[model samples]
Target: MSLRTALIVLTVVSVTADTMILPFYPQFFAQAFDVHSQAHVGYYLAACCISVMLAFPVWAKIARRVHELPLWVITQTLAGLLGIACYFSQSLWQFWLLSQLMLCLKASYLMIYPYVLRLEERDKHLGMVGLFAVLMQLGGILGAVVGGALLEHYSARSLYLWMAASDGLQVLVCGYLMWRLRQGWQAPQSEQSTPTRGWTPHVIRLGLLAMVFYCAAFFIRPFFTPYWQSLNPDSALAAVSISGWLFSLPGWVALLGLWVNQKRPGSDDHAQVLLLAMLYGCVGLWLQASADSALLTIGRIIYAWALFQITVRLELWLFAHSEPQFYGQDFSKLHLMQNVGVILASMTVGHWVSAWGYASTFVVASVGLLLCALCLLWWRQSDSRNAQPSHS
Candidate 1:
């Protein structure tokens, strides 16, 4: 297979395995470990995010010394092994520690986006990014569905086994890609200076906005399993897993549809699409927090769609402005900031949910997203005005 094909496959499998854990999340934390409250799931999720966030910059530094392909090979292998560890976790703390190991592996793997972008034709980059985003969602949806089925027919332990198998397969794919690269394939080098170019104010600002949106959107996710359990005390783990699958569907739809259209558009179009998506994302947040049952599902779907679109557009927007050679480093910074936001929000949301209840927590997150939307809106307007041609 072509390198791009191999990379896409790896991306799909890695993402699918990661998401499979979502449905079993609340159940695993609350029931399996018999945690004291629903919100404790956030602490577990936060632990994982914190490890990944802390490790990203380290991975970025490592990439500077070595190459992307080798880094992924090592990290992906670690991730797969950790999945086996997750299978044997005996308590909440054990699960949390195992997550730390998983994050170590995941930190390097997430940077595959920038790596893949480097391999693609410049003209095809944005659309391919979108396509990749869609594939990610497809993997997530399928993971949830399959995870749900696994929970229905077997124990949660089985889910981890599948994750382990997926990660192991990914290791082989990474090895194949490296072998192909030996045959004259090389990543595009960044033209910008390493220090002054990456982590710029503009990049940081956009990344921060994206991260905030991610945090607000996913703050509640760590608790979803427990929330479902609370809502239906008699519900089987399968029902909870199905809900996770359903929640991921809209995201996949949005990704597949818009990603194909994201050719090399003008900066103005990029900004417009991103801003609109963030706005809709806020609306999605409100809908998720305010609705119930079927309506809640619809809200989640819209939120997923908006979130995925904004995320892809934002990545494209950053790539457009970046010096090509610095792609890996800058992209790593983006990943760092995104995970930091997620980590903080996940930790904080646990406390909030524990104190205020699920509905109220969602309301608070929705409000935060609305504010984020407003900030981005203003940022866009300011950029437009600044770019206007000066009169003599």
Candidate 2:
């Protein structure tokens, strides 16, 4: 396979592994550890998110010094090993420590974006980024379905083993790609430059946007399984399977959105797209907050469609604004902000769910989404005004 194909495949596999346990997290904690507290689940997830956030800049620094292929190979291997060890963890504390370490090593995959972008021409970046997004969504879909099946037919331990297996697959793929690239690959001239730019206004804006967007999106994640249980009230296995399918609904919707985007290409109205997405996102969150379970599915579909568009455009925006020479570090900084948003959401959403209830948290999340939309609109208008010619 070509390098691009390999990278895409690696991304799909890695993301699949990373997301497999997500839909069943609440169930896993409840069954395996007899822990049912949303707050504890949030704390555990927050630990992983914070670890990834801390590791992003460090990984970026290392990427600047080491070759991408070798770095990826080493990190993927270590992460896989750590994941396997995490599966054997006997206590929540032990699992948390190991999972945090695993994520820190796994965080190196963030560099893959800049690495892949470096391989393609500037004009192809958006298309490539969109392709990556589609693959990611597809991976999530597969992960959810398969993970649910595992949980139903086998055990939560089996799901962890599957996750470890995915990481192991990533390691093998990265190692092979490294060996192949070693034969003929040459570093780009831009790679030699010292990256000096740090936290430009554009970068800060993007970071702030990421922080808000993810904070809104992830607030409901840790409690989703429990929320589904409250709605469905089925047997454990049935609930796991049903919720998995429910989670996959968004992936299907996102795929449709991707198809729509493809049918009408060359429309670079990112601001407009983002505005529409956030509008839909707010509606979706509100629907989810409603007492009807059927509305929850509709809400997920709308939200997923919106999320798909926003993620593609956001990455494209970041790539367009970043300096080529500093792509790795710049992308890393973006990842840091995104993870910070997740960390904040995971840390605080539990308290909100614990106190006000899940429906109230969704209302707050909808408001947050609305704020992000308004902020983006303001930024776009300001940019347009600045670009106009001055009449003397």
Candidate 3:
């Protein structure tokens, strides 16, 4: 198989493993460890996030000195072991240490994204990025649906066993990619010719924008299942499955949005779309906060469209402003920034769900979207002169 196809397949398998237990985290917490405190869950999640945020930079620095293939082979092997350790965790603290370590190892998987870019021409960057988004979204849908059903029949810790298997599969795929390279298989040479440089102001702005916007967009994810269950008390037995599917609701909408985005004529409207998408997301959040199931579905659809657009365009903006030599390093920084948003969202949502309530999260998330808009406006003005729009 070609390197591109292998990497894309790896992305799907890895994402599915990572997100399988996500939608039912609350259930996992209660069932696995018999822990019920929302605040404790947040702290644990924050620790996991911190591990991932800090670990990627370490791996990036290592990749600078080491070839990516060997580095990934070593780390992913360790990550698979950690997954097995998670399955055997006897206490919350045991699970915490094991999972945090696993998350840090798995964080290196993120480098695959920018690496894939190096093998493609510059003009197709947005298309490739969008394809990754849609593919990951599909993986998420399958993971959540399968995980929710698994919850009905299996122990929550079984998810870790499946995750370990996925890691093993990733390692085998990585080997295939390395082997093909040795066999004289050649992909398109990237067109980026910019001199290697350190971080620029525009790149920093992009990082900040991603941080704030990602936190805003993902704030409602952790507790969404429980919230949905509360609204639909009738779904007693199939609650896990239904809620899991709902958790992937955004992914479904992302498929549609990206399909239309690709089909539609390309324009230099990335800046306008970036701004408008956030505003549209805010409207969607407001509708979700209405506390009606139908409106919630509609709101989710709207939010998904906006979220995926921002996600694709942000990377488009990053690569357009960044240098090829520093793709891994710059992307690591961006990864860290996005994780900061996730950590913030996780902690704050834990509090909001405990103190304020689930619906309040939507209102606060919309406020975040507005804040992101303001940041985007600032970034756009500063970057208007130096960078050309990245459109086909």
Candidate 4:
């Protein structure tokens, strides 16, 4: 396969491996070791999130030192082994440790994102960003669906085997890409940058916004299946597979929104659009929290559309301001921040569900989105003022 094709395959497989167990984490914890505390599942997910988040920066740093494909050949191999180890883990703690290690190793796959950006011309980076975001959402949706199926039909432990196989596939793809690199194909390099220009206020602001925005977007995720099932306890339609599909409704809507945005004209004031999206997201969260009927599904569609808008627009702004040479580092920072949001949500929502109720998470999600919008408001005012002329 061509290098770009190989990289795309690797991205899909790696994302699948990373997220396959996410949809049914509650089930996985309850089934595998018979540790049935929902709080514990939250704590476990939080730890895995932290490991994966911290691990990406390390992988990015390593990619700078070692050639990436060889590094993936080593890390993905280890990651695959760890997945198998988790499959055989006998205790809760053992499984937790093994999965954490596996996640850290698998985090290396995220480096391919920046590598893809570097492969393209600077003008294409925004389009590539949109493509990768769609890929990630699709992978996540697929993983969730597969995870639900595995948990419902197969044992929860089967998730590890699938993850292992996916990682192994990534390793093979890495080898092919490495060989292609050796076939006298020189990778395009972005213009070299001075050290001082690495991270800017604009990038930093976007990272911060991404962290908060992601937290808001995903805060409603962990308890969703249970909540949906609870809402339709007696309905024959409330099967695990159906619940998984509704849970991924936001992703599907986001994909559609992405396609529509690409076909539309580009006259939008992105900052203003982002602000409107935040408002819509908050309203969606409110509707989801306030309703138990089909309004919940409507809320999901609205929330997903808003989420996609924030995502694509933020990326467009981020890459618009960043130098090409800093794509890896900057992308790492953004990815790390987004995971921080996920970690925050995962850490809190489980306990909230355990204590307050599932509705509590949606309530908090709305508040989180509102807070993020306020911050963006401040940022917009500050930028507008700074852009204006000043008498010296």
Compared with the true structure, all predictions reach lDDT values of 0.71, 0.79, 0.81, 0.78
RMSD of each: 4.0, 3.0, 4.3, 2.7
Error of 3 at 289 (Å): 1.2
lDDT of 1 at 198: 46
Candidate 2 lDDT (Cα, whole model)?
0.79
Q: What is the TM-score of candidate 4? A: 0.90
* TM-score, one value per model: 0.82, 0.88, 0.88, 0.90
lDDT of 4 by residue, 1-392 (tens): 67887888788777766787876776777778777787787787779779988999887766665767888889989988999999999987788788888889878878887777777887665567677778888889887666766766789888898888888888788787677667222223232222324567887898899898888777888778778888888896578767878877767886787677568644347788888988998888887876475888888788888877788888777777776567667878888888899888877776677788987888888888888889989988998888787733
Please tell me which predicted candidate would have the highest lDDT against the true structure: 3
Model 1, CA-based lDDT: 0.71
Give lDDT tens digits, candidate 2, residues 135-198.
Answer: 8778877777677678778767567677777777887887787677663233444564556668
Residue 222 C-alpha lDDT in model 3:
72
* 1-392: candidate 3 lDDT, tens digit per residue: 77788888888888888989976677788988888877786777788789989999887766665656666777889999999999998987889889989999998888888878988988878788888889888988888777867877899889999899889988877777677676322222332333345667767787888888888877887777778888878756337767767677778887886777678744556778789999999999998887688898888888888888889888877887766667777888888899899888987887677788988888888999899898878767867754655531
Residue range 275-307, candidate 1, lDDT tens digits: 777677666767666536555667777777777
Over 4 Å off, model 4: 183-199, 265-268, 390-392
